[model samples]
Target: MCSLFRCSSASSLLLAFGMAVVTASPVVMSIPISAQNAVPTLLTSTSKTTFSDIKANYWARPFIQAIVERNIIDGFADGTFRPDRPVKRAEFAVMLQKAFEQKRVRQLNAGGFKDVPPNYWAASAIKEAYETGFMPGYPANLFLPKQQVGKFEAIAALANGLGLTATAPASNILNGSYTDAPIIPNYAADAVAAATQANLVVNYPNVKKLDPLEPLTRASAAALLYQALVWQERVEPLPSNLKTANYIVADVNQNNQTPNDVVTVTASDSSFSILSSLLKTAGLAVILQHPNNSMTIFAPTDEAFANLPKGTLEWLQQPENRETLIRVLTYHVVPRKRQVSELSEGKLKTFAGKAVNIQVNSLTHQTTVNNAKILQSNIQASNGIIHAINQVLIPPNINLSKK
Candidate 1:
């Protein structure tokens, strides 16, 4: 008794959707400014008419090559692309313009940067970048064209230019007590934060802090653009061989209490008593009861829970680690009731607020996580659905995949 609908940007785009037979449900999904459903096509129009055979240089190789392949940018005669070289302001402006034009994004006008005089080449492109809220010049309107752009500055430009906005600070995003935010130049903070939330952070060698002022490397630029593309939903599908496990419905209340009605599995029927212990410890026994109509659990089987290191369960038993234990447990449960048929092949945003990639093999009737496999299927409960799994599906330190 449900229906699906999507209102894509305008009243003209509204559509009533048909119910999916396998899941017996209506799925209403609006297309985000993403590539998951439809990829944005870019024209391969480069300034170079016909360049000689060239090998793109490292540092800038990937991005330069990608741009060239996508026909957004190009290089000169020697046939060697110098990626480590700083990107000129003019070049960046042109790239930004091309990116937007290819995507058919709204055009932006340069409101008049002091240094980028109207007479300068690519003025419109530079202005469009600024007007689109991608890159803004200094407060006095000076466009420091000659200056080498830094990591943070370039990231900010990409974020704003691509229309990815920053979210408010999440309550649980462990910054590892990062204090670099205060040190980031005011102009770049917004960009840094926006990129960070979009998973564009591949900060290596120096993971703790983002040195906003440091000049960006060519490799870093490629990674940044790639991630920006991901944020825009230009993406890939999960591999078919990845293993997926089913979760059990342990629909707990806000207070972490399991339901009033409990289904006890005999010790003979299950292996690890971790479920009982974990539940009691999480203070969640009160919420996992009968009649949970809309919850799903990635229930780890007894043997799987028992497979943990000998001292692992015992260590979790210690009272001091209660909060940590709660998170571990909550990480396994998603807010939605997902049936097997509903899963699609790709990275999915989980109910636990992280992402997991899922791949299903029609030939095997099996689903996989990055590599983990689901051993069982829908185990229904009055309150929700539980899918028993073989291995203890530990939420990845990063996140989990939901399909």
Candidate 2:
């Protein structure tokens, strides 16, 4: 026979010990309780799981771990988390269903999409996502389940699923935040802006370059899902500098102050105006302005441009010569930030993905990068340091034709 105790103050302790306790008077009066018909409650396992492929230093490791621990996502059968692989629409729908609860607005007699048969594994999830307003079907009632989702589509779906609306102007939010703001479609502008304000957008290598058209990767999707959970107050925010948090509000006041990046410094300096204009033409300025990236630039003065064989500079500026222009400009940029004091004679990799030899004269304390002689050394910038050179360093592969 089993016995039961009616103790008000010891209810929690009894529960932890797998026994049921009832609340009674504090005077410790024993009241008879029935144990013959009572059911026992069981405790659940709360052990943490880790993936084999994900490492501590990976950019999206935290987000991946967050989703995995919540049982919203999983690794592949081979015990690897292929973060770089693309995610399909149907797979994303299944993940969305597992991550969030939705109330069924209505019932559909048939599967919402013609492509998704009733026997399909994810048919129910797709239908629920459509009915709950998380995703919309394509034209002719066709939901391309196998199609890879793009970055913009993922952000738009998250915004719609959570019912987020933009409080500020779309143009102000997008234009002020991303360098590719003009390319964002009109229909998705507001959704993207709302996602940006909610701190959902995360870009690697360069946070400022929001390549919306690129296919959404598995790692990227995990990051977005984690941020959505944070927005919904379902998860605690993680502390990290790689999150690209609060970009719009922080950069809004940058116009008044001098920017610390090499591109902005060159643009503001009268001597480097020619180089600045060329950088903009080649679409390389955006890379130099990336908030997370650090690099060293060997800027050539206006006099160097003037010294170019007559019409050479003009020919490179033409719209048809954009690729050649990019290659030429990237040849001047080094991927790592280095000061003059750290200089040693060795081969260094440039942003162009090629190596350039650096020579130092111990007697005169002079430096030369490639074939260009340094006219000025140690110009400090926020992202990296810069040195002025007397001549433009051209890559060996580029064949510059005289116009």
Candidate 3:
């Protein structure tokens, strides 16, 4: 839905996504889904008989592992993940369908496909898969389940399944070429383009080329599935359990139903040094003291701080740029804490008082936060939670939030 930019190495991005890549912890602010939204109750798939026997070493291990963790896919009692075993068309269709339970189940006729008979075990899933455009038909109406799925076919299936596409920023077109143009099959141009724009497809060893149409390997499938979940907003690392040791603040009086906020966010204990410095510099310490005020703050990591335009931070440190800094900081916050589950597809308000329009796929964990990923989230706290954001937020209109 939105163009994606490669922000950092996997370790760096994973650190933001809760994989703990950083050593510096941020201050223990209020736990927030975005604002003081989510508090405690933390946060899908099913297994199929077709995958009766799967081994851990199978290339599908990662895909199976992720979907399994999310409850989207399951395994047999014996504990096996079959990677090379071709998925029966019906079975593959069902697995795909299960991954996107967010959309209303597509309506289905009694039967679907030439090979998928009425008695076929996967009729329902295949039908849903086809209707959703995840698995379109070939030149003929046949869906040959017995025959193994090819490479490009699978890519098309997944790209369509999650409704993801990509593009380049007008400003960053000169950054670098990331896909191989010729090898990408003609039919997959748009899909590849979409993937590239979304930062979904990265050239392996070469950013400017894509070996499109090649049979996607089992490992590749796992990588793609992980990306899809990231894209869909389904898979999020749970907020790190924080030790509530420092602040003496009392919890807000609890008369209200928790605000229906999206993106509950919290900061890392390790990032406290960086967090404190920014708060002091932004002159937001007073806001932290006010008990009645409800807020959401998107704090930048040390890396974000380091990358600021030269003298930019020093200028913001001046009185004239105070509002600019506040607007930048506020742009990171929303009114309430919203975990990935609560984000509706559309524009949302930020503390900076500007609007950030986004396209979200709640099922796949696919999210584009103004072209960046939430990376890490739901860090718990007392006042409001923090979501570690990648690119610094700079709302276009600082005055918008004031009114």
Candidate 4:
């Protein structure tokens, strides 16, 4: 058996179980390696599965573990998963070959690219990758197998190969989801948009930063492949972790139902009785019930309304106090849809024309709006997402006592 030291010493670029070096004759060669450049082992093998560099809290750990366990990719030979390491085109091809079993759509020239000789370790993988339509070569027959694959390119390839097409305009999806949308190459925009719609794109640390031109890291690759598998329905979905869930750009068209869904949920919930009634009285329910109007509501529980100053609710309910009631209700409503994960520490302009202060406690994992803690969140509705707060948010410049 080849020892780990000897395997790491080998000059091979990552020929793992998933990215294995293959011969033209199709014989699987066994290579003994540490986690660094070795064949990715399943979780069943305790000795080979643990990568020294991947911490329990690492954002990509779940994705990497999933990919490795399925023999889709692997770490290095030094017992460390250098997740940030860039993956070359050939390496990506090998990963695609292992990760997907899509039926072949078409076959290219058998002679293959001038750059990829038959003896090349990844030659077979590259051939399969292009022939299956997952990756296409450049004009003039250049595969550029050694070149590092960019994040957008990899996503585009996956989306194209999977026959996923953008349901909406490319510009609409890109501008809404990515902060660096302007930099996304025109050629890959549609495919990337399709990939985003399919939830195959995962950005870590910051979800809005697509870093389109950045080279795809091993961690990013694993995350992407995992999502692709999810889209293909080959594996069951993983449990939602904050680190991963917040970063997945779910389908933009997911909330297409009538706004009655929102109105019904709020009106039916006993906890939101106070909020639902106030909205109806203020006439904001008309707006919330309209399918064209997208909005977010920081609904205060009935208990929160009771905690308000005595006579506050009574004063607002009076016919003379209707205007004040509208203002107060609008204060809790913000334009457009926002999930709990989208809330950051900043001022968010409310429908009342005044902004509410948003405070996020990273250490405590709590979000507060105008000092009111979010007791429950991410209640999905047709028009938007609703969050339940512990207190009613008052608009600035409103004097409840005088009213």
Best TM-score among the predictions, by candidate number: 4
Query: How well is each residue in 1-403 modelled by candidate 1, as lDDT tens digits?
Result: 0111122332211121111112211111111112212322322344342333334322233334444554434444344343455655555665566554322224333457677666665566667666666667676767765556677788778766654433233221213313365566766665556556555654544455666667765445545655555333343212234221011101112123232222332111354266766776666444443232135566666777677767666666678766555556655555444545445589765434455677888656577654557666544333344555666655566232321
| lDDT of every predicted structure (CA atoms) | 0.48, 0.68, 0.47, 0.73
Model 2 scores worst on lDDT over the 10 consecutive residues at 24-33
RMSD each, Å:
19.5, 27.3, 17.4, 21.3
14-51 in candidate 2: lDDT tens per residue? 33223222221111001111221221221122223366
Give stretches of model 4 more than 4 Å off: 1-47, 256-403
Q: Residue by residue across 1-403, what tens digits does model 3's lDDT show?
A: 0001122354432222222211211111111111111222212014342344545434334444555544544443344443444434445565566555434324444445666676655666667777776776655667765454554566567765555432223123212333244454667655544443333442233334445545444434444545555443345422234121111111112123232121111222454345555555676554443333334455566666666666666666676566566566656766543444345678886644477766676465565567666666544333344556666665675432342
lDDT of 2 at 163: 53
For model 3, the stretches where C-alpha displacement exceeds 4 angstroms are 1-79, 102-111, 169-181, 197-219, 236-403
TM-score of each: 0.42, 0.49, 0.42, 0.53
- How many clashes in each candidate? 41, 0, 81, 7
- The order by descending TM-score is 4, 2, 3, 1
**Model 4 deviation from native, Cα RMSD in Å:** 21.3
Shift of residue 69 alpha carbon in model 2, Å: 2.0
Error of 4 at 113 (Å): 0.4
